[model samples]
Target: MDRAGERSPWPWSTVRRVLATGGVMIAIAGKLLAHDPSATITWNREVSRIVYERCASCHHPGGTSFSLMTYQDAQPRAAAIKASVLSRRMPPWGAVKGFGDFRDDKSLTQEQISLVTAWVEGGAPRGNNPNALPPAPKFGEPRREEIPTSGLAVSGDLTIDRPITVDGLWPEHVPPGASMQIVAAWQNGRVEPLLWLYEYNDSYRHPFRFRRAIEIPAGTTIRGVPRDAKIVLMTADDNSWFSRLRALFRKTG
Candidate 1:
């Protein structure tokens, strides 16, 4: 008789079943590691703020595009939103990052973009707290009066004829789709980056207001503008005779 303590070895079929189960478990673990668990990110907490501040300008109801002003409106489009932000296609600001500092910039930061991606990948959950949502942004009609009347429009390369303080640049005439990089080369060989337009769409034209006014002395050459494209230098000296004359021409001619 066989010893009582001795037991029969496991069958080959049993070992194969165990191996298959382990493989499935490993695959599931790999998938989890591939994406953010998105355990903390939620529509009410973080995403709503980002969308309102950066996107609501054009995406709110009765605005330029479809409404992303509410969680219900945004949840369904989470995937598309993620793609747009990742590709830098939304917010519609054409200026490249790190080239110049501008106020009222609508472009999302890398961290903000990642948060959006994770929120989408994690199933776009609306958090438990509805109160976490920020206040809605106020929309207003475009102020045509605020647009500067006194400025110099330059089509090609231009050398500064006199010392002037530049406040900002407005892309006065950008082709439907064009890429241009404009720079200011100083007399001392310092090249300051002004603006870079990539695949610019003229329909959404707006002035790029600098963080602070830049004082450009005489002899600085504004270069890199395409002969076909025109950008206006919005200067601080609105009382200059040249500016007054140009404004007069714009009104009359």
Candidate 2:
């Protein structure tokens, strides 16, 4: 047996540091923020609400790597957010927008972009809603139909009931220091090898394993790891289809 043990890839400890603690997440968010006042819109409760409706489905917690659920999540990446939206990176979402009609679209309008910009410049204030916004959407089990049977499928005879969506065909912005962990295993004698990597909306990051593969047995209990855990684990690259798509359209648009 492979010992059925757990290991952390990174040389760090497990601690839930706040976002402002000057960690990798904060560092990246700070670098991506912009200083231009003219391009920003004054965001109040209303504006933030709109952003939540249009953007946060995927940007929010558990849907993907980062959570745009709170002001903290969006504030740090304000500049990057503007860049992606202005360039239609946040919403247009296809290798070329207007090429295909998608069920879920996260692209914002010019007005929406302006609104987000102003919100950031206005200090990204959070207006009062006695009840905080609902929790970010949660990911469910991978669905058999959702996985591409043409290219790859889960190993063995096993299948996922909930969908592990893979949005793609274009590029979009992902929050800095966002993290994700996928727990999967080989099935049916590992015929397909059960390769899993990150992709941006552009469907890039193919064969996305930057490091070596994290091999597992046919059935694995430790399918994934968390960012704050002892392991650094794995992350999808900038061009990953899932990363970009999730950032823009909420789901694999």
Candidate 3:
């Protein structure tokens, strides 16, 4: 130890001893942490909020999915809930972990997902305060539907003199026989997949909305190919029909 309380470089001969000490400390700390464990997770205080905000939108009546609004509704499905949320099949946001920052991101962090998993494995307790639970989530009403896109469009691919950005596309219309394919995303000259194929499935047919706007640098390029496809780009808030005829026949304000 020096006067500044910093250690000078250890002699090479003592390096092995120092490393061995660190290893032992790390192992002991790991065991201590394991013994302590995380706090017990429960539904009424924790898990319900996660589900109501993410799952109940689709899991409620008149909304095309089963209800998960109440403890009773969800208790029976605890295992499946844990499985789906952990696998990211629920909430349905498809951003690859650590890939991009997004607004309105439905996907939970790993810790949040783990809490749900632990709650289930720990017997899905309702906790001791059911009456104090937050009001049931009201996501099933008529409103803008949730969109599950592959991920945010990224643009660090370009070597630009200035920053660039792209306001996201909210696809409002698709002409029949039209299909769109996102082949790949480019970043710093490296190719990555942000691919999606337009299909007959309802989920695929629905328009995609980025959870937030995307910024495209001046030199970046996102290459996509369309085949016999007619997709009309519109804002997320646009409620207008795609057909020219529909616009023509609509009553004026």
Candidate 4:
């Protein structure tokens, strides 16, 4: 060895170890810096406009059932919101991929879904920028008033037999499979209207069981309806004629 001389070329193994350690450190740092784009956008601009435009019609205060107005209003229920959005459940309007044109569609855009997911993950921080507040949504121009329509009869009472979430399918995304069945008895108290609600977000003709009407109630035409007086029958997820005609009417409008 030379006097006061230092050493040899670095071995391959040592070089690899050093490189691996550096790579890991770099990865950790990148993760720290890798914030969700939605959060950044929202902090810059009140991105809740996506909600107002795409969702708040039904999911706003004094609306149907839920609200997506503000971060504070949404943060507590962030996880559920995430699940619903990712699954495309909250935007209850159902238009399957490649389906016909829908006039009043409310499915989320890819960017919107990403924004909501990112916001939820980023602690749902409502940025201090005073401008970060979208204008109050106006669900305008109500549809023309139609004649009083009779709701579908629930031949029998049925519950949400299977408990899981569903998704909404779009041009860029396909929802996961979710199957639920509703068992019902006909108004005649004999036939049953078995409704199978699948969440595949695809198109396929499926068969349902409902025997033709035999008799009508006094002063009442035979119609499928919920046995429970409290249950309010409404349209299914999608606005298909099949969904409208073969109704799985329930209070879970």
RMSD of each: 11.2, 22.8, 11.2, 14.7
Q: List the residue pairs that clash in candidate 3.
A: 59-66, 157-188, 164-216, 165-216, 178-228, 178-229
Q: Write the per-residue lDDT of candidate 3 for residues 151-220, one digit (tens) a residue.
A: 2222122122223333333333334333444322344676433334333223334444445555444333
- Quote the positional error of residue 60 for candidate 2 in Å: 3.0
TM-score of each: 0.76, 0.36, 0.53, 0.42
Candidate with top lDDT is 1
Against the hidden true structure, what lDDT does model 2 obtain?
0.42
Q: Lowest-lDDT window of 10 residues in candidate 3? A: 150-159
2 against 3, candidate with superior TM-score: 3
Clashing pairs in 4: 87-167, 152-224, 152-225, 153-224, 153-225, 153-226, 154-225, 154-226, 155-185, 156-185
- By TM-score, the best candidate is 1
**What tens digits encode model 1's per-residue C-alpha lDDT throughout 1-253?**
1378765487778888999999999999888865445456889888999998898888887787899998899999998999999988887887888987798778899889988998898899999988888889989884352666667777778777667777889987888879888888898999988899888886448888899888887777888888788788888665653644333222110
> Which is the better candidate, 1 or 2, if ranked by lDDT?
1
For model 2, residues 1-253, the per-residue Cα lDDT tens digits are 1256655453343333443365887677666664334534433444556666776655656554477666767777878777777666564332223332334445566667777766766776665653545444444642222322121222112233223322221112222333333344344444322222222333321222222333333233223323222211122233443333233222111
Query: Which of candidates 2 and 3 is the stronger one according to lDDT?
Result: 3
lDDT (Cα atoms) of all candidates against the true structure? 0.81, 0.42, 0.56, 0.48
Number of clashes found in candidate 2: 30
Ranking by lDDT: 1, 3, 4, 2
